[model samples]
Target: MNNEILPHEEVINDTLNHFSGKFENIFHQDNYDHYRSAIHDTLDLVGTFLHRNDKPFSGIEAKTMKKMVQHIDLNQKLSSYEEVLKEVDEIYVQHATAFHLPQYVAHLNCPIVIPALAGEILVSAINSSQDTYDQSAGGTFMERKLIDWTAERLGYTTESDGVFTAGGSQSNLMGLVMMRDVFSQKNLNHNIKQDGLPPEASRFRIFISDKAHFSNSKNASIMGLGEKSIVKVPTDNEFRMDITMLQKYMKREILLGNIPIGIIATAGTTDFGNVDPLEDIANIAAQHNIWMHVDAAYGCALLLSAKYRHLLNGIEKADSVTIDYHKSFFQPISSSAFIVKNKRELRILKHHADYLNPAEMDEEEIPAQINKSIIQSTRRFDALKLWFTLRMMGQEQLAEYTDRIIDLTKDVAEMITENQEFELLTHTDLSVLVFRYLRSDIEDLNALNLHVKMKLFYSGEILVASTKVDGQFYLKFTFLNPITTTEDVHQILNTIKKHGEDFGTTN
Candidate 1:
C-alpha cells in the first residue's frame, strides 16, 4: 500500500498537534510542573483574597452582580491563566460571602482549618472515587478508618459501619432510608429493596421534633411516603422535644392505626441549638419498638468536646446517626456521614452490578462503598479532609475549638439578655443564639427586625441569619468560628440596634 500526505491529512495532523499541547494541563507526570504552577497561582490568589476581605459580604446588589455575570462569554476561551483568574476575581471572589470572617455569623458555615485545606488540594489532584477498593486503593481504607474512628467516638461497638456523604441532607436521607426499609422488612415482611414500598407504607409514621431540620420531611417525600408521614412533636419552652408530647403523639398515632416506624431525635436544632433528651427519646423508642435515628449534624462536634461531650450522653443508643463535619468539625463544604449501629442494616441499600460490584465480589470479600450508599454511585474522597484534620489538629485541639464556640455563644446570649433592646428567646444547648431586636414603641416588631436584617445585608458591615418563630420574625447568630470573640458579637448586636433605631425614626 502506498501512503501519501495529502492537504487534508496535513490539516488533521496539525489539529492533533494542537490538541496534544492541551494535554499539558492534565495532572500527570508529564505535566507535573505545569500542574504545580497552576495550583500555586490559584492558592496565592485565594490567600490574597482571604487576607484582604474585611467584611462578610460585598454589599453588591443582586442586579449588579447578575449583570456582571451576564457579561462573561464562556464560549470565548481565555488565552492565559492570569486572565481567567482576573475574571474569576472580579465576578466571584470579590463578591463572595466571606464565611471565614469573624463577622460572618449568618449560617452553619465554619472557618476551615489549614490541614483540611491541604487535604482538599490532594483530594482534587488525586481525584479518587471512593466507590470501590480498586478505584481508591489506600483511600478506601483511609475512609473506612475515619468512619471507624467516628463510630468509636459516637460510642458505637464493632458492629457499626458508615460511609461519607455530600452533606447533612444526604446523611439524613440515608438514615431515613435505612429506617424505612428496616421497619418495612421486620414489620410487614416486605423487602423495600427488592419490592417497593409495602401496602402499609402510608400508615408508617416517623416522629420528629417540630424544630428538627426540614430534611426529614423532604426525605420522606422522596421515599414515596408523603410529608404526612412525619409527625412533628411539640417542643418544650427550651425548644427541645418534650418527652410528654412525644409519648402523647406516639399513643395518638397508634390509636389512629398509624404504625410508628421511626423517631428522629434532634441533637441540635437549627434555630435554637438545643438538644432533645436523647436518653429519654431512646427509652421511648425502645418502648415503642421504633428505630431511633439521631440527627446530630450540628451537635456531633460535642462527641469530641472535652467539656460538653456529656450533652450527647444517649447518642450511643441510636440505631442510626447523621454527622456533618463541614458544619461543626470545621471542614469544607460537602463532608458528612450517616452511621448505622449494625453494619448488617447497610445491606438494605446493597445492589449488584456485573461491571461494578457483582454479587460474587461480596463472597470474595471485596470492599465497595457503593454497597451502602443509595444516592451516590461515584463518590469523592471527602473522608480525607476529616482524616487530615484529625491527624494534624488532633482530637483535643479540635475539641477546644468546639468548646470555645459554645462558650462564646453563651456569652453572646448573656449579652443579648442584658440588653433591654433585644429579647433573648431561648438559651442554646450548642452555639446558636435566637433572639430579636425589640422596641416597646415599635408596634410591628417583626417588620422592624426584618428591616434590620435587610439593612445589615445592604450595609455589608455584618452578616446574620433570620428565621421566623410562631409568625414572628427573629434574628439569629450561629457561632461556628472559634476565632469570633464576644467583642465581635457585641459590635454586631450594636449594629443591629443602630439599624433598628434608624428604621424606627424613619417609619
Candidate 2:
C-alpha cells in the first residue's frame, strides 16, 4: 500500500469524504464546546514544546528536515485529526526559533506581553478587516482611536492623524510617498501622482544617516525616485548622523541644482541603536524648507519611558514619523503605524471606489479608512493587540517593561567592557550592543568572532547575531527581552569566548 500510488481523482474524492463533518459544522453556540476543545488541544501542544527546554534554538539540519517533509504527502489521508496535529508538532514546533528564551539575543525580536497574545487570538477568530467602515464596524473606530492616542503621546498637534501599517518598512514607504508628492507639486509644479515623474526626478534626492536601515533605499526605488536618489550622510564616532556634514551636503546639493526633498533622521539605528540629534536636524530641515521624517521604528517606545523620553525631544517637529510596536513595545510582529503632523495631507492616498467608499456620500454617512491608507483594501486588525495591551496593562506597566530591558542592556554592555577577551565597539544607546571576541593568539580576529557565532548557533544551546563594521566582523547582542538577566548575558559571552578560544587552538 505504501508503494502503490492512487489516481488524482480517487485521492481527491477520498480526501473530501475524510474531513466532511469538520468543514460542514458551523461555528455557532451549539458547537462552542467543540471549538473550545480543539483550541485547548492545539495550545497545549505548543505550550509543552515551549517549556520543554531552556535552549534558544533547535539543532535540526537541512538533510534531516528534507526527509521529514517528504513523508507528508497530499495523496494520503491521516487516520485522525490527532495524527495530523502530531505531524505539525514534529515538523514545525520542533525546529522553530525560540525568541522568548533568554539566551536568544540575535535581533530586534521581543518577548510578547500576555495581553497582546490574548488580543491576537480574539482578532484572528473575529477576522476583522479595517479597510472600510461597513466591513469593519467598531474595529475601524478602535484602530483610529489608537492612532490618535499614539500621536498625542508623541506630542503632535491635534491636526495629526495616522494609519496602522504592516511594519516599519511599510510605514517608511508611506512617509516617503507623501514627501515625494508634496515636494514635486510645490517645487517643480508637477503632479507626480497624475503626470508621473518628470525627467528632473532623477536629480531629486533625500538624505539619510549612513547607519540607517536599508528600508530607505528600498523605499526610494519603490517611489520611482531611484536608489541613486539617496544621499548617504556620514555618521559621528558614536554612529549618530553628523549634523554639520548634513548641512554641508545640503548646501553643496543646492549649488549643483539638485532638489532636496527630505531628510530622514533615525531614532535607534539597527546596528548601534544610536539616536540622531533630532533638534539640530529639525532646525536644518526647517531652514531649507525640506520635509523631516523620523524613522523611530526601534526607539519610539521611549515615548512610554519617563526617564528616557528626553532621548527623542524633537520628534514632535517631524513632518512624518514611523513607529513599530513589535520592536520595543513587546508586541508581536507586523504591528506598526505611519503618522503625519497634517491630517489633510493623507488625501493623496485617497481612492474612491463605488463598491467600497464612494466619492459622494449622504451627510449622515461616515468615511471609511480606505480613503486615508496606502493599503486600499483588506487590512488586518493588528491594532487590537496594542489596544488590548494598553487597556489591560496600562501605560505605566508597559513603560516599566521597556525600562527594564534598557537597564539590562546597560548591564550587558558593562560586562563586555570589563572582559579582556571581548572588545566593545560602541556604548549602549538603547538596547543594542556591538562587540567582538579578540585574543593575541588569533590571526584574523574578525573571522574568529564570526566562527564563534556559527559554532554557538549549531550547538543548539544559544543563538546570537553578527554584523560587519568597517569591513570587519563583530558579534551583536540586541536585548529586547525584559526578563533577560545579566547572568544570561554572562553565560552567552562565556560560550562565545570558549568557542573563539577552541577555534584559535585548532587553527
Local distance difference test scores for all models: 0.91, 0.87
TM-score of each: 0.95, 0.93
Q: List ranges where model 2 is wrong by over 4 Å.
A: 1-22, 25-30, 75-79, 362-364
Per-residue accuracy of model 1 over 250-300 as CA lDDT, tens digit each? 999999999999999999999999999999999999987879999999999
After superposition of all CA atoms, the RMSD between model 1 and the true structure is 3.2
How much does each candidate deviate from the true structure in C-alpha RMSD? 3.2, 6.6
Name the runs in model 1 displaced over 4 angstroms: 1-20, 362-364
Tens-place lDDT digits, model 2, residues 55-87? 977878879988999877979888765887798
**Candidate 1 overall lDDT versus native:** 0.91
Q: What lDDT is reached at residue 195 by model 2?
A: 89
Best by TM-score: 1
